[model samples]
Target: MRTVLDFTPLYRSSVGFDRMLDLLDNASRVASVDNWPPYDIAKIGDADYRITMAVAGFAQDELTVTQEGNNLLVGGAKTGDDSGEYLHRGIAGRTFQRRFELADHVKVVDANLTNGLLTIDLKREIPEEMKPRQIEIGQASSPAQVSQIDQGQKAA
Candidate 1:
């Protein structure tokens, strides 16, 4: 089921929230029926994530995993020997390429292929400057101290 959501009302009221609204508007336009080389995305830890792809009938050399900036690309190209005849041919042998958009500071830590599955591990490493930390509140200067400082400045 799909319904149109008009962001006109939000645009009229909200400020500095256009990016979030754009994301919501763009999300609905993405195709929901793209299920080639099925994959699963899971959050394994607070800042860790896992993307496991069911890549049966594909070899390690045939698959290529690349990370460029905020984008992750996973591609598989079946190499050599498709000449053999088959009756049923149930197993899929089509080449596939999937792209994943990663958040800021999210990096691909490791990737492994085992038992017909490809698993990619991602960890979000927030920079020290970006991570939330408590700011030490300092005591405000008293009126007496301010007046003394002003007097000292005048004397100088």
Candidate 2:
């Protein structure tokens, strides 16, 4: 049985969370999709993440990784064909495409394939203008300085 959740109440109380809510809804809708070429997402540091996917029987040249806005796409396609017949085929080499939605400011840093495992590194880089800054408070001006400003105004 499939369960459905209502987000209307959440929307009524929260503000600036539309993207997160939409992502949750989309994940629920795609929950029944195929799980071919299993993958894992790990957090290495405060702002660093890694995604590893099992891509056995696929060559490095046959795989492609791309990023569009806040979305990351990984795809694989078999290059060579099977000319000989097999008595029992067990290995899977079918083409697949996976989509991952990333948070704001998150970017793809590097990607590598080793031992049939494809690893992708991601990092979140906050811009200088967007980073938190300290504000300096000013104290009241001295009475002498205020008086000098008034006298200068009268002379003018």
Best by TM-score: 2
What is the per-residue lDDT of model 2 for residues 1-156, given as tens digits with 9 covering 90 to 100?
A: 768878889999999998899888878887567798899999999999999999999999999999999999999999997797999988889999999999999999999999999999999999999999999999999999999999999999
- Where does candidate 2 stray beyond 4 Å? 139-156
Candidate 1 displacement at residue 24 in angstroms? 2.4
How good is model 2 by TM-score? Answer: 0.84
lDDT of 1 by residue, 78-155 (tens): 997888788888898899899988887999999999999999999999999987999999999999999999999999
The superposed Cα distance between candidate 2 and the true structure at residue 114, in angstroms, equals 1.0
Candidate 1: segments with Cα more than 4 A from true spot: 8-17, 144-156
Error of 1 at 92 (Å): 0.8
Local distance difference test, candidate 1: 0.93
